[model samples]
Target: MADHVLDRPPEGAAADWTIAQDWSAYSAADHETWDILFARQQQQLPGRAAKAFLRGLEVLRLSKPGIPDFAELNDRLHAATGWQVVAVPGLVPDEVFFDHLAHRRFVAGNFIRRRDQLDYLQEPDVFHDVFGHVPMLADPVFADYMQAYGEGGLRSLGFGALDKLARLYWYTVEFGLVREEGGIRLFGSGIVSSHGESRFALDDPSPHRVAFDLERVMRTRYRIDDYQQVYFVIDSFEDLLRQTIETDFAPLYGRLAALPDLGPADLLPGDVLITRGTQTYASERAGG
Candidate 1:
């Protein structure tokens, strides 16, 4: 969902990258778009998405309709987990982004995509930011993981390993899966937010659903323009938090830097295969 990363601050701003949501500035059309996208995804996510993600929706009252006001949403979120959603012009610099997360502030873009762009948009907007990501912040474990990631991001800056660390975010925060009590379920915001990807990630069988491996994931490249060829699965939120927070990434980064990068579709012999993907979907798309 985070396709843009602003490297510099906007002109004539008091701060580096923060902006006002100006919630009232949104026209009727914007609110309607939220309603449409929200309703559409809700229908698709019921069976396919992680149960925690669904519960987050209700916990935050995301179902109340229209683009959420940051102030209002913050009231509930801050109460529940000390996490609050804030407004951003778009993507902020890496440090700014990490700082916000480190402080439990989630930045959301102020705009919404047009009706025609409903299916896809390269850059993240409010719906993509808030609707896609914020719900999971309702979960105590996920909230802690996000904060840990932010703190980790700051530390990672020193290791000269943001690229490797970013893949961890991509495979987990944006496009991860979980094995629930019944079956595998979608947890990544990127999947939960997309009507097409939600179904594609789970039921397609064309993409590999590999179990979470920190080193393998960091060494792997991911696709931004098409459906992910692989999705990493976690045992639970605790496992993910423990893996990232407890482990010192410095040595891991040094070792990974020397290793060759794995393509989005590549599966290592040692990979814990959840679904051995055929890559049919990616092939067909590439052909056309």
Candidate 2:
């Protein structure tokens, strides 16, 4: 989620961009905002969200009234998987982010979105960072995938493929879907965290649901301004971790450099189509 670079830490942040959660500073209104956002997503996600995420929510006991105290949240998180959540000013520099993940520390923003912005916000607020992302961190296999992604990100910098590598994170960590026993389930933080998208990603006919291909994903383009037109589905967390841990991306980077990138909605000849989207939703959005 740390997608941007900061010239330096803001006035109060540490060198690594870490800041105290300052949990006590949150107003009752802020707590109400978290509760409102939480209630809606909880209502939306059951059967729609990945089972691992649900299990993580139960394990972490994030059901309490207010925004979680990081100290308490970390105790449950660290106990489940060797991971802890730290507060950050906002998006940290990419390298700083990789370093944090490489060591199993997840950086989250300390603020919540205002009440009016419950549906959307330009910057990821605390709810999106913690409620949207942390639950999955409790899963052992997914936790390893995140660490592997960080280690891979550090390596990608030397190759000047951060943008391409970023597409991997955008597609998987932020907007990915996974095939479970019953059907495809939402695993991506972007989808699960969003009440609108949690349903649209699964029920709407406008977006393509395709199987995950590492290189194809790296070469694809994604939209940040709206709901995704496509989502890449993984076989399982174990398969994803296996692929990421075992692949050597240096050679893959070289090959990808010469290929054309795919648009968010482009359906290719080789794509494994799970749901061939009509793209009616995106088309209507553009028309309006």
Candidate 3:
């Protein structure tokens, strides 16, 4: 379970929570884990991830050696984008997460993954949080999209539409792509963070990359335990904001309520299909 947003800090607390970010507690092995992951991802991201994401890496000075000090990173981030990263134990509650995002404060899990779990980790660690997410936050359009999503999240909570809204976040923030002059480039944190997924997402023929449709996305399902079966593609971050911000979601939610949910790889009549995936990879997984 994620941490709840409304939970109050203890009385007269020196900081917000008791989980003092014992920086020294990080052993040499832990630092090694960060270094290895950082080096690998940095090498892989070029030509794969969006330009803005790469620029963010330079701006944050994250390309330097060893694990980054959160305090130092925040100082630079706050100055650049009015966004700051806060350390949390792991996934926090929906409201808590939304509240932080609404205020341009991203709550990242402070821990880094152990070397053994490099390929996959069930929970989001510093690699997933900072490496995957932070870079894009530097872009003004993407930054606005995130803050708007946060406000929408809080609104969705009032309407009991968190599940639907979460699907949007998962697809857009976690695994979405954007069309560029050269070709489609990665923007979603999930795709940017994974070495294999980065290649698979662009090079493979097993998943459909369709133009982003808000109504379709809200009714679509996503996979958590494996690679994404379908990915939504956007023209630009500006397109994302223009489409989403101009429309009120109340009616859209009502419209989606009457429709059936789409499976991970399933394409519909409404989709602006880029590729009709063969689904060979997904099918093999199903068989196995």
Candidate 4:
């Protein structure tokens, strides 16, 4: 899962949700944890992750055997997408988060997960932020989508529609999939970040892999506490970008305000179902 923005910025900081990375302060264990997690995911992502993501790993030098030095990493990242990574203590507030995105800056959590908690952590840590999220920023199309999402996020707030916009983020940025030439592959950072979910999201028969639709995605709820019960599939990154950027969200948001919502497990007649998932995961979780 991704970390939300923390409510308070540090005392006297110029920007919200940003703090110095203190890159030199990390211990040997911290870097070791990053390496282990990085190696595990590196081994795991090849066939499952988006090719753009893999290329990003190399371009960013994420497999360098330690938590990345942000200054060093930024040199390459900025060259690629005009995006730079910044450090945050944990989650930051929404407005601050959108503001960063609008400006093309990514906020990352500075700490690494514990050895025992390597498989899972309650909040996103360094590996999750850098390994999971940063690579995609290397891709121009995905980079544009993120910045647009950030701009849309700020606009959505005025409409009292952050929840709707957040669902779009959940389905697209956090848990999205795309149909590649041979088959569907993972693009969403949430799935790419987790070993179990990376496989489960593709191989498991329990979730719908439906074609992405703007309104259906916005009104739909998502599962953050478990493997996603549904994943939206896009034809290409351009398809995702064009849809969001071209749409007049003001009217679309107004239209969607009155519509009934869907659950993580629910599918509608209008949904373009790619997998028509068996949803055994949800049933098993509920002990049905």
Against the true structure, whose lDDT is highest? 2
RMSD of each: 1.6, 1.1, 2.5, 1.8
Between prediction 2 and prediction 3, which has the larger lDDT?
2
Query: What does candidate 3's lDDT look like per residue over 1-288, in tens digits?
Result: 233544555443224332445567788888888888888988898888899899999989998777778878878888888898877765566776788889998878778887889989988998899989998888888989999998888888777777788888988999999988769999899899898899988889998888898888988899998998999998899989888789898888777778888888888887899877889998899899
lDDT of 1 by residue, 1-288 (tens): 244544467774338577788899999998999999999899889978888899899999999979999899999899889998877777777888898899999988888999999989988899888888999999999999999999999999999899899999999999999889869999898898898999999999799989898899999999988799999999999999999888988899899989999999998999999889999999999998
Q: What is the TM-score of each candidate against the true structure?
A: 0.96, 0.98, 0.93, 0.96
lDDT of 4: 0.88
Please say which candidate is ahead in TM-score: 3 or 4: 4
Judge candidate 2 against the unseen true structure and give its global Cα lDDT, from 0 to 1.
0.92
lDDT scores of the candidates, listed in order: 0.89, 0.92, 0.84, 0.88
Estimate candidate 3's alpha-carbon lDDT, on a 0 to 1 scale. Answer: 0.84
Candidate 3 vs 4: which has more lDDT: 4
Residue 215 in model 1: shift from native, Å? Answer: 0.8
**Which ten-residue region of model 3 has the weakest summed lDDT?**
10-19
Ranking by TM-score: 2, 1, 4, 3
**Per-residue lDDT for 1-288 in model 4, tens only?**
235444466674546757888999999999998888778788888888989899999999887878899999999999999999999877888888898999999989898888998777878888888888899999999999999999988888899888888999999888989988779989888888887889998998888889999999999998767888889999999889999899999999898888988888788898888999998888898895
Model 1 CA deviation exceeding 4 Å by range: 1-7
